[model samples]
Target: MAEINASDVMKLRKMSGQGMMDCKKALAETNGDLDEAMTLLRKKGLATMAKRADRSASEGKVTVKSSGKDTVLTSLCCETDFVAKNDDFKEVADKVADAALQAAPGSKLAEQEIEGKKVSELITELVSKTGEKTEIGDWAKMSEEENTVVGSYVHFNNKMGALVKIVCENPSEKLQKLADEVCMHIAAVKPMALNKESFDQEVIEKEREIAKEQMKDKPAQIIEKIVEGKINKMISENCLVNQKFVKNEEMTVEEAVKDAGGSKIAAFERVAIG
Candidate 1:
């Protein structure tokens, strides 16, 4: 077997993005062969992921990467905030986002590869280093086309964000600005759905049931009106288009979208982790 020097281990660390000890061990196993060490590291990642399969990974960052007229939102979730904040974890997440962006729209992000390694393999490597569960979470991709505007926002903490695409007769800087503002609004408001039509029907019925119970003492006619009023108010608050505009309280997001180029919010997705 060849000698494994400190420099060779460091080189493997850079190449595999695994921890120092892992790099050293891989080098030893590979007889100081850099390429073989990298392969060993990736294979180890799979075992590590399987070992920690039951761990709950609830924390991480949402990455919104944009290139030209396209944008991809991807999240890397880990077992704790400490691991989520780790520099290596963040770098891997960014790489995943980049790979997702490069792949065809709607591609399964975990299947995408860097060099010869699948993204899922890369994540398992980090799981081994951190001793924490790590996996990809919510993701979305958007490609802008004629007569449309795209906007996206990732909160300062990077734990939550939104991406929005709007349709207009003629896209412009002004409309784009509104779309950006709406993305921020989405981050702040965290709407449940684009509109009431899309809101979960069972949830809607449940709300109506709750309202009926609350007003059960009133006359049937009065109770009926009160229940409907409460349901409408609840829908308005939860639906994205019906929710009050976060920037200007005077209008609903629907009105705001209309005011900016007589447009409609064509598509949106909000991604978050806790």
Candidate 2:
């Protein structure tokens, strides 16, 4: 059998996102065959992650930026809170987000430019300089009518961020204040959907299973009714528009939007530490 070294295990861990000991074990099991070890690790990770899908990812930084009606938001995550707080990490996060705003969704980051440098090159340099693994966690952009202005709230700390695009109906201090409040709420409340109707099919289906399990003792018809009601309740609570307003708690976010009159929230983006 080939000798499995520390460097070999480190390489496998980074490539497969598996635990260090697992990587070492996989290498030993595969007789130090890197490719075979990677495959084993990936398969194992798939199984492990599936079982722990509910694990909360709470270590990440939110970044938001806006240009007119065009807005973008992103999340950058690391292995620990200590790394997330690193100044170098934050700088790289900002640069990556800037590069993302310049590119459209589903495009290659290698093709994007930041400060006249390709993002791919920047990533390489940053990794070497920081001595830490860095990857772009998420990227999203929103745009409205060209004439309208985009507003952003990056929050008190780098912990959370938001971008709000407004459509001209009219711009007033009141409207801006309302928009700011909405952004703050996004960071604090973390709604999973924009409206009840907008919940993803997969999310609904998963919730349906949970509801059925919870109401299993009831009559079949009653169980289904209960499941449907549970799904609706989840939508109202998890969706932004239907959620109770974070600021007031008495009104739904939708009500606040309607009260804003002519001004409309064309789009919004929010992210928090994982």
Best by lDDT: 1
Question: In model 1, where is the ten-residue run with the lowest total lDDT?
Answer: 39-48
> lDDT for each of the candidates?
0.86, 0.70
Per-model TM-score versus the true fold? 0.87, 0.69
lDDT of 1 by residue, 169-257 (tens): 99888888889899999988889888877888898899999999989999987998999999888888888998889989899988998
Candidate 2 lDDT over residue span 1-274, tens digit each: 7799999999987765556887889999999998898767655534544444455545657777665555677776655677678776677678877877788865776568888777755555444333344556566777655435355676766768776665556666665677778778877788887765567889899989988999999988788888999888888888877778887888777677667642455666776665
Winning candidate number (TM-score): 1
Clashing residue pairs found in predicted model 2: 68-150
| CA displacement after TM-score superposition, residue 256 of candidate 2 (Å) | 1.1
* TM-score of candidate 2 relative to the true fold: 0.69
Tell me the spans in candidate 1 whose CA falls farther than 4 Å from its real position.
Answer: 1-11, 29-36, 103-107
Worst 10 residues of 2 by lDDT: 124-133
What lDDT score goes with residue 75 in model 2?
71
lDDT at 135, model 2: 54
